[model samples]
Target: MQVSEFHLTAYSTALFSTWIFIEELGLLFDAGDGLSAGLLQKARKVKYVFVSHADRDHLAGLLQFQQLNGRADGPLIHYPADSGSFPALEAFSQRFDPHIRGEAWRGIRSGDALPIRDRITVDALRNDHITAPVEWAKSLSYRVWHKKWKLRREYLDLPGSEIKDLIAQRGRAAVSEEVATLMVGYSGDTPVEDYGRWDGAKLLIHEATFVRKEDQDRARNNRHSSLEEVLRMAAEIKIDQLVLSHFSSRYSAEEIDTTIRRYGREFRVTCPVYRLLPGQIHRDVLREEPVWSL
Candidate 1:
């Protein structure tokens, strides 16, 4: 769960609420109800927020969040460009909290990249969770990338003096090229459609709202992923850690964990697997003992 130094905290429950706060990046993935209450003063550190879709369970706490921590210089919120609910809510937030201003509310589409830091950027990828066509922008997933440079393989054995001299003559860019590493991938809410969507991610946080194929029928009215489908997909991908959330309250914690253990063994999964149980706030979720450890 620890990708370099980022600490992730979250609360998720299907049809009720869901949100994740990343401490190192000052970023929040969603703004479900009780966000302000759960994070308290720590919520002030959030400088950027990405909302996945227009579902009420995903955005019910925006008003409280804005009122509590919104300022002229912090907490920019982004959402799908075609989600009309956001614009209307933005206008309502402005009028409801007349004293709050300068908080940027932006409309973003797939393929857009927003820099969270000088060397870190968050990229959005469209996902099929809102029943919108591929041309429409109604839902999204996010990936956080860290940009860095390392000595070229050919120059690794070069003398320090020569390397410094080469840098003076040709600049550091001549010897090294920038590379981006996928630190974390957030699959907001979607069906298990692409196994490669989160491949090679150091950590992946995904939603598994149902436990079985039979239960998936109940979720058919809305787009969602089932636990079996998600784990099956994870077994095929290259991820260091997997955190599943947004499970329905219908299943008990024991039921969810038991099912996860069975799947982990059946799929021969080798990475640590974690789950966020219903009606609970998980702090430093990665640090907690995974439901099924490697």
Candidate 2:
């Protein structure tokens, strides 16, 4: 599936709440405040939810979300393995919503892959947001991959009839191989590092909490990325579309847009770049006019 085909809705403001919903996949990244209120009926359609960290701003909405959509069969919630907060929340949710049984709470770590669809998988990657011990898993990013098939190199040049015959004789697996394309990458509140991890994705949704290096002091604990850092990373990567979120409330829309344009020019970034303004719930984020369009 194409990343462009998904309808992405998001509301992200640093320290308040941050969430992104992919309507097509029924997938959600982070369940921050107003998640249930913002998504409303669409919240029920979510079959998979991934929480990046235990930060209150990242998971405060899970209570309302679970109250509305928790079931005994689906809508699994995934979180960092070493985060005790998720288990506590799950327990509280169980007690608060005694009738909901289908909600499965799972803890995952870096390199874990969970299939959300028959051919689509979400893989977790450790991020540098949390400063826990080496063995502790507290923060993560995710990448979505779509399975595709192609004729094996050895059979690529074969005639149609020959390929058909081979397929008939040896089965499809023998004639073709399965390939996966990185459809989307979501950097949930992470500093811009390891550009290779997100490169080549069709869509990259990352955080730009600070627009300037001087404003880094605004974050007291977890490290955050600056707009300049993100732009520099974007310039060096091979992403098709970029969606930036989790901007601090200190900056106005005009200032954020202007900075994005400035960095786009400085970095010679050609990809369309979209940003979620503070306190606003962006609907069909990719469909909206990008702040810096080539």
- Deviation of model 2 at 1, angstroms: 2.2
Candidate 2 lDDT over residue span 130-181, tens digit each:
8877667799999999998899999878999999999899999999999988
Alpha-carbon local distance difference test for all models: 0.90, 0.91
Model 2 stretches with alpha carbons more than 4 Å out: 217-222
Candidate 2's C-alpha lDDT? 0.91
Give the worst 10-residue stretch by lDDT in candidate 2: 213-222
- The pairs that clash in candidate 1 are none
Q: Candidate 1 lDDT, tens digit per residue, 37-81?
A: 999998999999999998998999899999989898978999999
- Top candidate when judged by lDDT against the true structure: 2
- Name model 1 segments beyond 4 Å from true: 1-5
